[model samples]
Target: MGSQAPGKGAKGPRILNVNVGVLGHVDSGKTSMVAALSTKLSTAALDKHPQSKERGITLDLGFSSFSVPLPAHLQHLPYDELQFTLVDCPGHASLIRTIIGGVQIIDMMVLVVDITKGLQTQTAECLVVGEVATSNMVVALNKCDLVPAEERPKAIRKAQKRLAQTFNLTKFAGVPMVPITAKPGGGGTGTSAAPDAEGLEELQAHLVAMVPTQPRALAAAGPLLFSIDHCFPIKGQGTVLTGTVLQGAVAVGDTIELPGLKLSKQVKSMQVFKRPVTKASQGDRVGICVTQLDPSLIERGLACAPGTVPTFNGAVAAVEKIRFYAGQVPSKAKFHVSVGHTTVMASLTFFGLPDGQGVSQEAALVQMIENLGRMALTGVPMPFDKSRDYVYQGALVIGAKFDGDIHGESCRLAFYGRLVTLINPSKPAELQQLRVYKMKEKRGVIERINEDQGNAIVRGMFKKETDPAIYTGLRVVTGRGEDGVIESSFGKSGKLKVHFAKGIQQAGRSSSDNAVILRCKRYINEHDRKRLRQ
Candidate 1:
């Protein structure tokens, strides 16, 4: 998707948050359903937005605020002032990148599917996007009443079956595929109550179960990462940036920098909704008045961070799964990726999966050549360590089914950034005869019946580092790069380049200790116990 103008006002911090995104294909009833569910006060922007009103389309990312009543289920939360923020994303194919940009930060999702069409291309695309972002999802079968009164049952079942295939519904299989009359015209107020069925009570219960009361793991001092959704200028106020406060807290007089800009801003004033607030926490949407800096520096994809997060020029990201919309050709071109509000344009064509890795390797993220003929930011900043990968950052268009699968200006053929093998910066396209593989298969290393290397586990480069680095283990893992590889031939000067981390050095050890490496023996014995219990 092309860039969008920043949102109104600046951003401040508020603590309690439930950030959610609405998703589906174009005309899949995402906006209308969102407007209906949001409170009367919350429905204003969505109701008045020009694109939505006149063209009947959601052009840019739209924002509205709402609070979900904690139902009988959430009375146990540790804090109050909790609320839900619903971000309405464009369901069209063109907005795929922008859709994921917002979804990356959301805690949960409400996937709206049209009951009449059942499941469309955007539905499946968005489903994969949601899965990649977060596991929690609520399926709202909008426009259910449009189906013949009797056909509603079939419509509802169709939704239920499709949902089970794509989402992790173990939390509650009986979730509400709530049949809703989601049109904005004439008395189309949304369902304030959960749908009626034996499924109704169960669905309401599941909504409470799946919708986390608060962010799962809120870091105390990782870094302040503010993803700017809206950037605008004021008469005397200078410039202000607004969006949900993604992470960390900001205070008055704190200096904030525009990501790519050399200058920063000082906080002038801050407000959350209507109330004046001081320090904001992860999730609250606040407006901050900043003094200093050029407004031009503040752009939509600009990420404001206090301390820098570790970024690699080239990285290998595992594709947990590669799925596509039925009947649509999978996007064959290399993928351009956008995560955490930053878009990296790389010509990452797909390679086969890794064969002998310990854990099942997903699709790998490789660094590709920047198609000067195709994109702007050729090099993307891929983060490392203590990172939380969102399930559906957005939708991926598989190559096989490309054409008629996408519609209108959305099906616009464009080059994309892909996660690919980082060539040794010294030599581009270094793989001469050696085949490229993203190691994603599952492998686990266990000690033999008797061996001195009792504490170590051997596996692929992709699995999480399980053993203490002190063990002097030789495990394979992905490497990062800047210079391209020179040659494919294996030789002394051309060693398969590997990076040594500070922690891996700590894994150094000569002999065993602890009476007999008791932990290993205990683990092996308990393994059989666990299997039996399962």
Candidate 2:
């Protein structure tokens, strides 16, 4: 059954939405399986991107959904109906980042494998990425028709053995593996060219038996946090953003925040899997239209919520060492870090560990500095109260040696990280018109009015003196770490004596001619004046 009405009685299947990711190496039958399933039982399409048709490989994420029969045994459970939005992730080595993006939002995955090739390089990397996402996995031993019918049992055993050894320490231990023949043009017998309806039926039954529809705690309530994976403008519908909802729910007429873009927008419309819905909850693949915002302002890897999510350039987190990673945690080592849907370059600065040396298997707290992107924000940032039991609640994944042929046998090291204390850099002060003062002696410089100045007018919101709210004792900062504070605000010009705690330290000289000052201008703009105009 397709996605029916929300409620269900004992007679019919109850429609429960679940997102199942189809992930594997390139040419591993991920797209084929989706096409065949959609053709037979559902109404979703796969490989709609033009690049995918030209190259005959998935270059981006493709989505297709279908409904499978709920077994008689499962009918008595909480929700008898199960509808899966199959997320087909690209498997090419160059597109591994996109694969991580797909894996980031999946609840479970169907790992398709070519029975002949066993486990390729990208396949292993996909598994590692899925592990970091904490998604449940079930393997599809595809292309079974390529091997002789007599040798099918042997091929299945070999794939199972490799998986057991690879997942010795992970939660993927003893993951169920099934055999199938995903033929060309969505045809599969138990082989390459012909289609076998019975074989497909068995596979669907297995899926229904293995996966369950479960609701997550605290997902229904909280700020409506959604990540944007694709954005574009429609002819008359304004801008649309498409992605899976990571947490909470959103409805039409609700206002949301895009912190990175510094814009607030209202939800004009919402569609889930091409069916218009009044609201979308977590795990639903949705496309949302907002009120006339520029699509260019939003891109992949940005998040939307009820308000601006907390952003920081650096954080101090505890690194949980993966047993399979062969190398030690190097100091200042650059790695691509993925948090939520945002991935950026970050460096690790190790602190004291158990042996007071290189990284051991034991967990160690380290500082993570965001070296590349503008900022790193999390779905749920740490709350201000530190004494709570769960102070560190967010998750991070680090990928190293990703450049060049990442699918080589030697390059397999990507693992998850945990946060301890998130480090937020000093925020820049609001822009203001003030000049640096130069005293006769360099040691005691004070704030001074700009030269060639006239009697300033208090026109509009412009004021002659600084607001008293920003007086002395407030910490002042310029270009990171170069900090000072207002010691005295005692003049008509609101000139304050800035005392540099560490003294003015600049390049080249012990003291410099210009002292960078930080100030918060308290002028009301047009937008603010409207409220006060009444």
Candidate 3:
């Protein structure tokens, strides 16, 4: 069932909500545009944060929505009313985590750009985030009235051309651009004071036209997963959690679990924009009230059906490096990983199939990983299967230039991936199953050879404190093309005895400077274990 509109037993038309993210650089008029278009404001809408009003910039994600009657093309859909929930994301560079969190819930995006400034740093970053997060987007060239009347058209065209060139390498190439004056005369008290917004009607029409093309399956059958963005207390009523219903439906009196705190509470009541709703489905933005929970504990987190979400300490994912990032993505490098609304420091281990060895195997694995990534980008969940084997990559170097000037200021999005395996502390065996490895090789010269015993003492391969037992039973090759195996430690010092299967060659015995090389694969997790012990 769909959420009810604001009224008492009036039985208004069923609501179909589409979340649209407003993102751009700081002071790009994203909030102004949202304020102009939104007809209804939620409790947390329009600079609700004290710092936002004080600093004259948005410091957090703001919410406001407007409703439009269902267009004729979408009449065959399930719902009769269309609501666009505007998610105004912060544009400051420091608040990119918030923008990432907000973009996760959006069905599409309206990227606001300052007409004069064109695409700034955060604007480019927001475009990158949009490329990874959502599939559909429309650019809003805001602040058109700032330019002279005669020069407005030329300036807008120049900005559009620059934006087109920027998007040429991205998936959002050729997306529609609408010039608008979100706030005329550079200031306005509210939407009522600024009624003559340039291109407002045209922008609205473009949004409506794109609505029918959006892919939405509002089936409310899966386990309920609500992304709580705002939490507050209602005095005697209870604590209310306001967020979008990402998956499944939630009804009043049903129990939902706060996965972060590992606590479950009954849903006392629910509302959609001040209207009492008995039930709400996927894509609905609603506030749920429950008793006895402190509002301060959870500012942003996931609320879901009990036992549905699992906590993992580490995860293995199929990853591809971002082309814009110039730095090297070495394995085990730490990065800020944003999962849903939470951003945490995570050490990534990258792996893939060895080239030229497995043709069919590589094709199948790549296809599977690509499918998983596509499904995830579209907000679909595809569980990682443990039955399949994944290839291990020593490092992710594809599409990267090591010879170029790597210190340039650019987007630091090194790579993105879809989860393949989750490592839980409680399940130690899961970590043991990871077979990622790095190749290690050591070179030493054969100092002395025992012709009678058919063994040679190899030195110079390791330091004095190095353990020779680790290389025991490993194959070694000589400079003269002779193959042998490391027999055992010769003495307390770092020396090993090498034994040839067919017996030491005549060249090996005559030349004491024959070089011996040992090659072995070292697992990365084992290296981590050794470092931890140190």
List ranges where model 1 is wrong by over 4 Å. 1-15, 40-44, 47-49, 69-77, 148-155, 158-175, 183-206, 307-313, 316-318, 325-333, 349-405, 408-534
lDDT of each residue in 282-348, candidate 1, tens digit only: 6656667786646675556444454353333434333322323222212234344555555544433
- Candidate 2 per-residue lDDT over residues 210-268, each given as its tens digit: 66433454245565667677788888888888877766777778887776665788989
For model 2, the run of ten residues with the poorest summed lDDT: 432-441
| Better TM-score candidate (1, 2) | 2
Give me the candidate number with maximum lDDT: 3
Worst 10 residues of 1 by lDDT: 513-522
What's the residue-level lDDT of 299 in candidate 3? 85
**Which of the predicted structures, 2 or 3, would earn the higher TM-score when compared with the native?**
3
How accurate locally, in lDDT, is each candidate? 0.48, 0.57, 0.72
Candidate maximizing TM-score: 3
Which tens-of-lDDT digit does each residue in 215-312 have in candidate 3? 47757767888888999999999999999887788888899998778799999988888878878777788999999999988888888888887655
Candidates ranked, most accurate by lDDT first: 3, 2, 1
Model 2: residues with Cα > 4 Å off, grouped in runs? 1-14, 39-45, 69-80, 158-163, 167-169, 184-198, 212-214, 352-396, 418-421, 425-534
Tell me how far the alpha carbon of residue 86 in candidate 2 is from the true structure, in angstroms, after superposition: 1.1
Task: List the candidates' TM-scores in order.
Answer: 0.59, 0.65, 0.74
